[model samples]
Target: MGAFTQMIMGYVYPGKPLANATFEAYAMMCVDCGLTAISSFKLGLYMKIPPKAMFLSQVIGSFIASACEFATVWLLFSSVENICRPELLPRGSQWTCPYNQVIYNNMMTWGAVGPKRVFYPNGVYSNLFIFFLLGALLPIPVWFLARTLPEKKWIRLINVSTIFIAGASMPPVSAVNYLSWFAVAFFLKFVVYRKYKRWWAKYSYLLSVAIDTGVSLMAFLVTVTLQIHNVNGIDWWGLDVSDHCPLATCPTARGVHAEGCPAF
Candidate 1:
């Protein structure tokens, strides 16, 4: 477990890694994942699956789902980068089309460069990865709790509240680029719940709530901690670099300039 934690921390914090801090973050994420898996198993059991099958299915499903999530982050990052920086893209790439420049720019502004820098100046990749992971893993605990007590309206309300909070905590920008993942999750959840209504019914509402709350809390905490540690006392989440950029054509300017030429 220690070695595994180190490996994940390496990917998350990246530059000049602080072993203790990295370990804590990694451990927190792992604990969160374990809780989610246990919750999922309980929900599965409630859906009438045999105990053994429920355990096996939860293990298999969680592993596969986690792997897919990691893959999704990689793919989404690449796709967004390609779209936003076409001049940097390969000549033969399909994403390099002229018509797609607008699409690319929009995604770049919303997902990769814009929000990334604003929310995580030190390292955007790891921060975004953690955000996505939190969102992906949180449903487990909620599902379990929901199944345990399916009659409560507050559980459903909490789940809905969490979703909104998670969305709110996310970088706070236009919805064009970021909405894709939400849409995907929504559609996928709809299909899963619709196709296996009985199974989903035992935990869907709770699972939704759990995921939302967990993700929002995690993102908020990390962002706040990093800001306090590295960025003086300012609220980094509220800082907007775009608002400070110069509008003129003196392309050689640098840093956070409010007047004079725009920096290249």
Candidate 2:
């Protein structure tokens, strides 16, 4: 919802990168904060935690989190040379900043460059407008199938919304990420639940929390201890690059020459 709103802002007020960035940042922040608050509130309700205490904790946590996030970002941008510039970053560097690169590309495409130039009737990507219609209508068949064939429990898994939502992260998240996530999820949710229902119910959430915390802590430690001091860790083929197909990013439009791509 926040992303859609910010996209509308991009369309309405084009060619304003700063405004776009500000709008997107705040809009996403508000959305994330609200969703997180709601989830925490629900968890608190389940645990029978007092509302007042939860509210107070949320307030304190928000301040500490925002400060830490700001400091981390400041440290990253300050310490890492060519932090968001993929073209300038050395090959095999861990600080490629994939997410930042996606954000910047989006800012240029939908904000600074404006969707009008990219998605106009005669534009290269005008066919993308069909997605609006497809998104709206795709659920109808699924709805009908579920209603007509109530016996098939698996039909409910054919979720168009989830597909689109997952697709939104694809530019920064590759096939390996998705495959690994799906594999882990299937193992935990399906295999674990079926084999050890009691253990799954009691420890699944804790495991998830631990994994999140561990990854975050390790990332922060690596940034401060190794990356800040330019100590390269784990020089290997796997760490060298994520996207093997460099030509996949090239413009498909005729006569559009991008560096390294063959001229059409």
Best by TM-score: 2
Residues 99-130, model 2: lDDT tens digits: 87778887887788777787854358878878
Question: What is the RMSD of candidate 2?
Answer: 2.3
Give the residue spans of candidate 1 off by over 4 A.
1-21, 62-164, 167-169, 172-264
lDDT of 1 by residue, 1-264 (tens): 332344344445443234434454567578878888778777776677788887787778878989999996576466444443545643333233443443334334333333334334544343554755676667777777778889865565456436745555233243543676678577657787679888787777787779789988976575455432333234454233222434532433245454555545
Model 2: worst 10 consecutive residues (lDDT sum): 1-10
What's the lDDT for candidate 2? 0.83
Q: List the residue pairs that clash in candidate 2.
A: none
Estimate TM-scores for all models: 0.31, 0.89
Residue 114 displacement in candidate 1 (angstroms) = 21
- Find the number of clashing residue pairs for candidate 2: 0
Instruction: List where candidate 2 sits over 4 angstroms from the true fold.
Output: 87-91
RMSD after CA superposition, every candidate: 16.7, 2.3
